[model samples]
Target: MRRLFPALLAVAAALAAAFLLLPLVALFARVSPGTLVVRAGQGAFRDALVVSLKTSLIAHAIVLGVGTPAAYLLATRRFRGRSLLVGVLELPLVLPPAVAGISLLAAFGANGLLGGTLDALGLRIPFTQAAVVLAVVFVASPFYLRAAIAAFEAVDPRLLEASRTLGAGPGRTFARVALPLAAGGLAAGSSLAWARGLGEFGATLMFAGSLRGVTQTLPLAIYAELNVDYPVALAIGALLVLVSVAVLLVIRLVPSWTRFASIWPTASAASSSR
Candidate 1:
């Protein structure tokens, strides 16, 4: 029975892998290199790719700038309502993209809660490039924040204490000790956030209106092309798949690279002492 159970699990795993890979295999099989090249040269494809890259990069910057410190605070501090705060921040991680879009609309749309104030200041958010960036940041920031908090928490408290003992202040200790040790995890989180931002669709389409060259990211472009130009859609989908695979590989490789970097100096020092 035990042997049979293991065999059954292996078969199930293989089936799962095949299920996931088959669609991607078929997609690439249908998209020839010549078709991809032709689509890539089109203005619409170029615009969508450019917008996607630009907005996602901006969103990634926002995530890193804001999420890193916020994560550190969450990791090291134990204040009242901390759990509630974390839950609220992480809500977007599980929230449907459509719901996220609606929430943004309620907050930032014309006649929305803050719309009057924004209008007075001449700052419109909905149906613009900025809205696209906001949607990406809204959905993707949680991934980086959660990962960053875990990474910071994983760092040794002793190291922080030692840095403090050496006359480093809190900020200095965090900068020198915590960040270095947690860098690999941060990199992985950033990659995840970037990938998520790059692929964002529902929220962007709803809040940003899918305006070509303004809010039409790669995913939106794919949707626009699906019925009108199926070949272009397939080509863009293949590009997204390749980018996603590369990001996943980077996420998988970063920790090993960090580990090797940490080990090399110690080994060199040991050899010198010997």
Candidate 2:
């Protein structure tokens, strides 16, 4: 029975691995290099790629800029409703894609809560490229914020005190000490946020209307092509698979790289002393 238990566990693990990998394997196998090359040159693929890259990058920048400080505050402070605020921010992470889209519409749509204010300002959001960016930010910022908070929380409070004792202010200590210690986590979180933004679909489609060269991202392009141009969809899926693999690899390696970087100066100093 003991031997059988280990064997059963191995079989289950193998099955899980196979189950996860089979779809990716089939996708890559179906997408030939020629098909990818051909699709890459096509207007639909090119335009969607450009839009996806542009919107996702812009969204990533926004998330990092706004989310980092917000995350730091949430991690360091003990304020009223802090937990509630975090839960609200993280709500999008688990919300159904369709629900997320509707939530955005309810908040920003023509007759939504902010609609009259936006109208007074003559600012249109729905069915535009800006809407796509907003949707991406709405869904993706939480990933970064969650990760950044965790990263910030992991920093040594003593190190923070030491910096303060050394005459550093809050901003200086965070910028010089806390941020460097948390770089690996920040990178991993930023990559995840960027990937999430890149792959945003339902929310973007609902808000941005999927117009090619305007708001159609790669995932949206894949959806638009799935029925009419299956081969192109396959190519885009392959591209996403590749990008996802690279992101996962980076997430896995970043900690090791950070550790090595942290130790290198110490090792060099020891060698010089010897």
Candidate 3:
């Protein structure tokens, strides 16, 4: 019975692997690599590719810059309504993509919550390239923020205390000690957020309007090309798959980043010498 159970589990695992991998295999099989390169380099595909890379990278930078501090705060502090705040921050993770789009529009759309204020400032957000960035940030940041909070929380509290004892301020401790120790988890989170932003579709379509060269990203390009040029759509999908695989590879290497934790003691020594 034990042997039979193991064999059944193996069969199920194989099935799951096939279920996940076969579609990707089919997508790449549909087009030759040379054709994919040609299509991806020409016409609207090129424009969409450029826009996606630009906006997704920008969104990732914004998340890392802003969300890191925010995550650190939430992870290190115990305060009133912290749980509520965390819940609100993570809400986007569960939100439907269409709903996420609508949420952005409600917050930044002309006639939205801040619409009048933004217009008064001469900044229109919806249906522009900036709107694509906003949409990506809105949807992708939660992934990073969630991961970052867990990473920061995972740091050794004793190291932080030791840094303080060594005359390091809170900022110095965070920058020199906590940040290094958490690098592995942060990299993992960053990869997930970047990939999520790269594949963003529904919210961007809703908020950015899919204008070629302005707001159209690769996913939108894929949709636009599906009926008009099936081959081009497949090519774009293959490109996305390639990028996703690269992100996964980065995630696979995150354990190596744990080696950065060794820097914490070095930081404490520097602080002691000061």
Candidate 4:
């Protein structure tokens, strides 16, 4: 009975893997390499690729810069409402992308709460490149933030205490010790955030209006091309899938690499001592 159960589980796992991979294989089969190469030279494709790269990179920078400190604070401190605050930050992780767009609009759109003030100051966010960046950040930052918090929490407290006892300040200890120790996790989180930012569509479309050359990222461009240029859309979709797969590979491999590297040194030292 036990042997039969294991065989059944293996079959189920294989079926699940096939289910996930078949669509990707079909997508690739439908796209011609020659067409992809030709379309890659087109101005619209180039512009969308550039826009996606620019906005996603900037959004990732924002996530890393802001999320790191925020995570460190959450990991190191305990205060009233801390859990509530974390829940609020993580809300967007589970929130529908369309809802996130609407929320951004409500806060920053014309006639919104802060919108009038921004209008008076001659600052506008909606339907612009900045809006695309904002949308990406809103939907993607939480992934990095949550991972960062966990990474910081995993660090050995004794190392931090020792750093402090050696007269290092909080800032120094964090920069010198904590950051290095948590680098792998942080990289994984950043890659995930970048991938999310790259694939962001609904929030960007609703908030940024998909203006060509200004706000039309890869996903938006794919939508725009579906009716007018199906082949180009397929090419772009294939490119996006490739990028996404690369990011997923990094996210999956980084933690394992870090764990093995961490363990190897400890094992070696123990063996030498024996």
> Considering only N, C-alpha and C atoms within 3 Å, which residue pairs clash in candidate 1?
none
Give candidate 3 regions above 4 Å deviation: 1-10, 257-274
Report the candidate with higher lDDT, 2 versus 3.
3
- Residue 36 of candidate 4: its Cα lDDT? 78
**lDDT for model 1:** 0.92
lDDT per model, in order? Answer: 0.92, 0.91, 0.92, 0.90
Alpha-carbon RMSD, each predicted model:
3.3, 3.4, 4.4, 2.5
Q: Which stretches of candidate 1 lie over 4 Å from their true place?
A: 1-7, 263-274
Mind sharing the TM-score for model 2? 0.92
Q: After the best TM-score superposition of candidate 2, give how far the Cα of residue 10 lies from its true spot, in angstroms.
A: 2.9
Q: Candidate 4: give its CA RMSD in angstroms.
A: 2.5
Task: Score every model by TM-score.
Answer: 0.92, 0.92, 0.90, 0.91
lDDT of 2 at 222: 94
Question: Ranking by TM-score, best first?
Answer: 2, 1, 4, 3
Model 3 agreement with the true structure over 32-101: per-residue lDDT tens digits:
8999889988998999999999999988899999999999999999999999999999999999999999
Runs of candidate 2 with Cα error greater than 4 angstroms are 1-3, 263-274
CA lDDT, candidate 1, residue 215: 93
Question: Model 4: per-residue lDDT, tens digit, 1-274?
Answer: 7699999999999999999999889879988778777887787788899899899988888888899999999988899999999999999989999998998999999977789999999999999989999999999999999999988988888889999999999999999999988888888989998998999999999999888899999999999998998878889999999899899999999978987777426546879999
